[model samples]
Target: MRKKIVAGNWKMNLSLEEAQSLHSEINDALETSEFNCEVYHFVPSIYLSTLLESDQKVNVGSQNGYPAKNGAFTGEVSMSQLSGIGTKAVLIGHSERRQLFNESDILLKEKVDAALEEDLKVFFCCGETLEERESGQYKQTVIKQLKNSLFHLPSKEFAKIVIAYEPIWAIGTGKTASPEQANEMHKSIREAIEHAYTQEIAQNTSILYGGSCKPSNATELLNQSDIDGGLIGGASLKSEDFLKIIATYN
Candidate 1:
């Protein structure tokens, strides 16, 4: 079966003390809980080492990292640096990074390659804006993102990837795609992967839905045929809310 995962993008939120408290709560809860889905918290760069030092069951990752291993790129951390510090994953091509920082597909492709080189699992994100969605061209937009940035990889390297489909329009906007809409897009994504790779590869790929997902809506969304889990946002900041979403898989 494809891996079910619930990953939180803390997105520059939470101070060090708050992060510690939240992480502790999550760890303490998991100690008594039973669930099958993998759990991860993609936190700010500054708090990575500190949070990771704890024996928390939650997996930790960086929100962004440069493609270069070591360089004069001031203010940027390389994938090598993250991996060397025991981070097991990184989020690439998130809509905020694409919109705010102007990260082109070319650069994202390089980041994917670099992260995989260091054996870090890549949570590659792809989605469409409201304009594209209204125009009914959202499918093409999302497919183009995958083809441009991720399709270049060989199957072996691609196996380390987990695709997160976060509708740009719904993300942080308090809007969510109905379960049907999300599953339709997710099925389309799986078809695209099957065309590029093999049926087995497509079947095994874990495609997550990420757009204002919370405990209230997570059950319906996760119950969809194609959606395996979520890339949670606002709700993830709260330990109680995040754990509720995790229990959806059970």
Candidate 2:
């Protein structure tokens, strides 16, 4: 069976103290619960070590990392550096990185290669913008992202990667793809993976929905056949809301 996961992307938000307190609150709530899916906290780089220092229930990962092991690249953290500090995973090609920071697919592929080399699990995010969606080219756009950045990897290496589909228009806009729409895109993504690799590999890969996925809509979205879990945004910042989404998997 595929791995079920709900990862929280605390994208560039919260101060160090706020980060710690929020994580602690999540941990405290989960202490007595038995969740069916794996949980991950993808926080800002500045707070990674402080959160990882403790033996917590949920895994911690970086929101971004440089492709190089180490270099004079100021303002960038390397995959090796992250691994050395016990960081288990990293997010590659998030829409914000692509649009806001101007990270191209070529650069994202290098980051995927570097992260996998260091044995860091990669949450490779890909999505379509409002224009692409409205143009009926959303599938083409997203598949192109996978083909350019992630499909090059051999199945063995690619098997370790988790795919998150975040509709760019939905992110941070208080908009969400309807459950049917989200699942349709997810199914397209899985079909693309199947064509790239093998049927078995595609079946085993976990594809997550990331948008305005809050407690209210999580169950409906997650219950869709192709959506394995979620990459939560705003809901994750609140422990109660995040926990409720996790409970939906049960």
Candidate 3:
């Protein structure tokens, strides 16, 4: 069976001290609970070392990374730097990055290649804008993004990758895709994988929902056959709510 994964994306939030405190709370909660699902926390670069030292089951990850291994790129974190600090995964091509930094598919693909080359897992994100979704171009947009950003990689190299579908309209908007809606998009993305690789690879790959996922709706969302788990945003910051979401798998 594909393992369920709940990844907390603490995007552009929390200071070093606050991150340490939050990590303490999360670790304590995980220890007391019976949650067996794979858990990851994508914190800002500064807290990676501190987060890695925790004795919790939560894997360490970064919100972003530079496409180059190392260079004179000021303010850019490289894959080598991330791996050296014990990061297990990196978030790539998030909607906010696309909007704020104007990252292109080519840049994202390079980042994916760089991360995989350094043996770091990747949570590659893709989604459509509100206008595209309303115009019924959601599937097309997702397919194109997948094709451009990831499909070029060899199947063997694909094993370290996780795809997150975060509908732009729903992200941080307090709007969520219904379970059926989430399942439909997830199934379609899986089918796209099947077409690109094989059914076995498609079934084995973990696909997550990432749009305003919270305790109130996490169980319903995760219950869908194709919906493996979540890429939690705001809800992940709170220890109690995050643990409640993790309990949905238990």
Models 1 onward score TM values of: 0.99, 0.99, 0.98
Candidate 3 lDDT over 117-205, as tens digits, reads 99999999999999999999999999999999999999999867899999999999999999999899999999999999999999998
Stretches > 4 Å off in candidate 2:
none
Clashes of each: 0, 0, 0
TM-score (C-alpha, index-matched) for candidate 3: 0.98
lDDT of 2: 0.95
Q: Model 2, 1-250: lDDT tens per residue?
A: 9988999999989999899999998887778888899899999998998999997988999999999877789999999999999999999999999998999999999999999999999999999999999999999999999999999999999999999999999999999999999999999999999999999999999999999999999999999999999999999999899999999977
Task: Compose the digit string of candidate 1's lDDT tens values, residues 1-250.
Answer: 8999999999989999999999889888888889888999999999999988988789999999999989799999999999999999999999999999999999999999999999999999999999999999999999999999999999999888999999999999999999999999999999999999999999999999999999999999998999999999999999989999999977
Give me the displacement of residue 63 in model 1, in angstroms. 0.3
Give the TM-score ranking, best first: 1, 2, 3
Span of ten consecutive residues with least summed lDDT in model 3: 27-36
Shift in Å, residue 32, candidate 2: 0.6
Model 1 weakest lDDT span, ten residues long: 27-36
